[model samples]
Target: MRITLERSNLLKSLNHVHRVVERRNTIPILSNVLLKAEGNDLEMKATDLDLEITEKTASMVEQAGATTVPAHLLYEIVRKLADGAEVSLATATDGQTISVASGKSKFSLQCLPQEDFPDLTAGSFSHAFKLKASDLKMLIDRTQFAISTEETRYYLNGIYFHAMAEGKALKLRAVATDGHRLARAEIDAPSGCENMPGVIIPRKTVGELQKLLDDPEVIVAVEVSDAKIRFTIGSVVITSKLIDGTFPDYQRVIPANNDREMRIDCADFTKAVDRVSTVSSERGRAVKLSLAEGQLTLTVNNPDSGSATDELAVGYDSEPMDIGFNAKYLLDITGQLTGDEAVFLFADAGSPTLVRDTDSENALYVLMPMRV
Candidate 1:
């Protein structure tokens, strides 16, 4: 393939697809990116068996052809080139080496046959819908942090995406949990999405999708089937296989009868938890929250290190109660809040506590308490 592309444009496209190529691959072709030049655009594709990303960019095509080259090497070469420099890529007649030249620098990279690259087929999608980039990004950012990293309970390793009817209105929801904490976020369901099948979007796919949603003005096309899901934004397409596990009924885990209520500044609560947890042991960084009328105190005690305590004025009128929770978990849930204050509903020191942003009715968090 012979094509000339500006350094900035080429680097942007490379940065999008090269991340899908793994550094070490059992199959040599899997480590390379497939490049095709035709018409006025150059197409780049990279995959790691389970996930695939393809992107196209406008370029000057001198001779239309296709070849495969090391993804990381090409990315690095183009990245180090001077801004606005023109990069030319041409394959030798033997089709085994590709010459890359820019400015006064030139290098030849070994190439693999394009036919050796495996194609990730996304079967027919049963449901397709469009979502605003900002909405999709908010759903993921709110719940992805709670996805389980544990390999055994594979079902919790992704966000459960589905559509549910809330009264007469339908809502699209994403829920994630790691047994200790759970996060749920929902948005008004877009047209034609009410019948979409529930799917567990793997963690990696969620991360890659977030990158594509950086442009708030972009609208993403989402397609889903029983075994796979695809997302297309502008000229970029990402296809990923859904996890083959059933997500637990998350609705049952959210407590609906929690009585004790407390409202406090989200930022203040986060900072207090962070400071008190400094003296906590690494293994169990638990902070105790003592709530009483008009006052809340956070304290952490560690046998190996020391103890810390902090107090904050909050709006709590219920009877005095003390609850222990992981400091990190509290910070994570509170960090996602976009509003100034957070409301907490407590059942008891032994039961799960429900947390929510006072200004947002579409997102909720549940944290199981730990014994202090």
Candidate 2:
């Protein structure tokens, strides 16, 4: 295919789709991106069997054709080219090599036949809805950190998306957990999603979707089926296979009867936890929190390293209680809270502790305690 594309335009489209191409692939074609030029646009597509991304950009078309080339190599070449320079791509008559030219630089790259590229066939979707980019981003950012990385319990390796009744209204909820900690966030359910089926969006898909939601003004169209989910924004489309495992009933793990409450400055609490954990061992990284009538003390002790202790004045009026937790987990959950104060509800040192942002009612976190 012969086409001319602005360096910036080509680079932007490449950056979006090239990430789906694997660095090493058993099939040669899977390592390349399919490029098709027609009319006034050039389309780029890349896939790694489980996920696929396609994007289109305006280009000057000289000849209508298509070919496949190494995705990373092409991206690098376009990235290093002079800024604002126009890049021209023309395939050889033999259809085996593509000549790339920009200003004073020129190179030829070997290519595969376009027919060899596999097609990503996403079946009909049962549910389709539109949501603001900012809302979708909030749902992902609040819960993505808690997704489990363990391969054994595959169900926990992604974010569970479903519709649930919140008081008199139905809300869309995202929940993620790794056994030690769980994060839950919800947004008002969009129209036409009342009958949507629950789906487990894989971790990779969640990451890629985050990149697409960077523009706050953009509206994203989401389509879901039993086996796959698709997201479309403007001329870009991303399709991914949903994990087949069933997610456990997360409600059972959330503490229901915790009555003791404490509230502290979110930033101050995070900094204190970070400083005390410095002395903790790499494997354990546990920090002990002792809460009393009007004071909270954080301490960490390691056999090889010295101990660290810090105290903060908090609003705790219940009986004195002591709890141990992973310092990293505490920091991660605290980082997601946007308000100034973080509220914590505790039952005892042995039960799970519920945490929330005092100003936000839509998000909550549950962290299991560890023995100090």
lDDT by residue (tens digit), candidate 2, 70-155: 99999999999999999999999999999999999999999999999988754799999999988889999999999999999999
Q: 1-372 in candidate 1: lDDT tens per residue? A: 799999899999999999988898889999999999999999999999889999999999999999999999999999999998999999999999999999899999999999998888646988999988999999999999999999999999999999999999999999999999999999999987868889999998998998888899899999899999899999999999999999999999899999999999888888889889988887998999999899999999999988999999999999999999999999999999989999999999999999999888999999999999
lDDT of each: 0.94, 0.95
* Pairs of residues clashing in candidate 2: none
Can you tell me which runs of candidate 2 are displaced by over 4 Å? none
Model 1, stretches more than 4 Å misplaced?
Answer: none
**Best lDDT among the predictions, by candidate number:** 2
* TM-score of candidate 1 versus the correct structure, residues matched by position: 0.99
